[model samples]
Target: MAEVRTVAIVEDDPIIGASLAQRFAIEGITTQWWRSGEEALAGFARHRPQVVVCDIRLPDLDGESLFGRSTRLLGPVPFLFITAFGDIEQAVRLVRAGA
Candidate 1:
């Protein structure tokens, strides 16, 4: 069987983070849930997940900045941004800037 893809989630909201992690788990995808960008970056080297789902607002750093740095380190893995309803425009701008 082909290996399942691994996913990393960087979200501050506990409920959302856990729910997403659980959903991925149920689908047989490996997931690592992080509450802060700093925590996520610190362990990213070890985890090396194939996809990253990150909330735009984080305690330590914004998801855009984290995504940029992660791309530098990990060479452009897929990134999905989770933004507040009001921040959708800002998220789009970030995505256009290569975040």
Candidate 2:
């Protein structure tokens, strides 16, 4: 994997999204933070990033759904899923799917 210069953040929570973007910015990484799956999907169609940090439960599509739908457009980009619910089954599924 090459050095990641940019990351796309898909998170509904304003605080978490802003914080992640801020931290990435501090490290001199460019970030495209989207508040919903629809918005992220649209942005992704325009430009795919090196990595994606997405919330498990989004406003429209869930993380898994978004991953499934974006795989073709995003290619082999890495995905990191976040969730407060701590669903082990979903985590296993995601890991198995190469998230």
TM-score of each: 0.86, 0.96
**Which residue ranges in model 1 land beyond 4 Å of their true spot?**
1-4, 85-89
In the range 23-76, model 1's lDDT, one tens digit per residue, is: 999998989898998898887988898889999889899887898888878887
Q: What's the CA RMSD for each of the models? A: 2.4, 0.9
Cα deviation of 78 in candidate 1 (Å)? 0.5
* Runs in model 2 lying further than 4 Å from the true structure: none
What's the lDDT for residue 19 in model 1? 94
Candidate 1: residue 25 Cα off by (Å): 0.9
